[model samples]
Target: MMMKELHYSGSFTVNKPPSDVVNFITDLPRAIICIPNIINYEVLSKDKARVRFRVDLGNEVPIAELRRVTTDAHIELVSASGNEIRYKVDGRAAGSTISISLVIKVEGVNNGSRINWDATANLGRLLQMIGRFVNIDSLVKSISEDTIKGFIGCLSK
Candidate 1:
């Protein structure tokens, strides 16, 4: 069966240093709070976490469980350089198996830092059939944008 792919990218500026930004993004507990659809997260270990998300797909909230594999956060001293945090998430939801990779970069800006988020998801065949009618890319973008905004809010507090 052919698989469906979705990609999303977004960038925002935050009033904090790159180190601070990296720290904030790496905090799974704090970051999970920003996910509008996330019901909760259970930490499996120091580097692994399971997240229960009620994803809003315009019809209803589909309960999904995702396991995250995270990379150690890296920070660069150069102002133009950025810190990077990468993770791979796998889950099942809406009668489909989902897999995604997310990378977030925080770079020092004029007064603070700029955050760039990039994510890619591969959906099961069932979702691809549905995507032929709806724009899955847009939906993914919206979700990504909201998630990042939630991260930003978490840092502001």
Candidate 2:
């Protein structure tokens, strides 16, 4: 079975300093709170967390019982710099690995920051096979929205 990989990059500006945005994005525990449909989330350490979230894959084009994936995720911040942060999420959902990685870069703008987010997901064999029959754009959009929510949540604080 072939694995399906998803990748996307986008940028937005927040009314906060670059350093503040960077700090918030690097905080895995607080960031997790901003994600939608979070069933469970625990801050295991400064760099790692245990998370569980619900993903509804729409009214199952080919099956009914398998449309929803309850994901168990292990999230970590692998690296960080003054303006860039790299994180990893190792997750299992519906008997498949839904691992993802993200890199965020924040740069100072007029009075706020221009934040760029890039993410990739390595869907395991099972999901890859199922992906061919499903529209994966919604999943991708969900991930992007989740990340942006975290950014907004951070700036709001």
TM-score of 1: 0.80
Off by over 4 Å in 1: 59-82
In model 1, where is the ten-residue run with the lowest total lDDT? 69-78
Model 2: per-residue Cα lDDT at residue 134:
79
Provide the RMSD of all predictions against the true structure, rounded to 1 decimal.
6.7, 1.6
lDDT of 1 by residue, 1-157 (tens): 7676777788999889889988766766555557666666776554466777765556422322222211122111122224888777777755677888888888899989998878788887656655665567776777678777777787777
lDDT agreement with native, every candidate: 0.67, 0.82
Give the top-scoring candidate (lDDT): 2
| Every model's TM-score | 0.80, 0.91
Return the lDDT, model 2, position 133. 69
* Total clashes in model 1, counting residue pairs 3 or more apart in sequence or in different chains: 0
Question: Which residue pairs in candidate 1 collide?
Answer: none
* Candidate 2 lDDT, 24-92, residue by residue in tens: 888777677888788988899999999988878777547776688788999999999789899998999
TM-score of candidate 2 to 2 decimals: 0.91
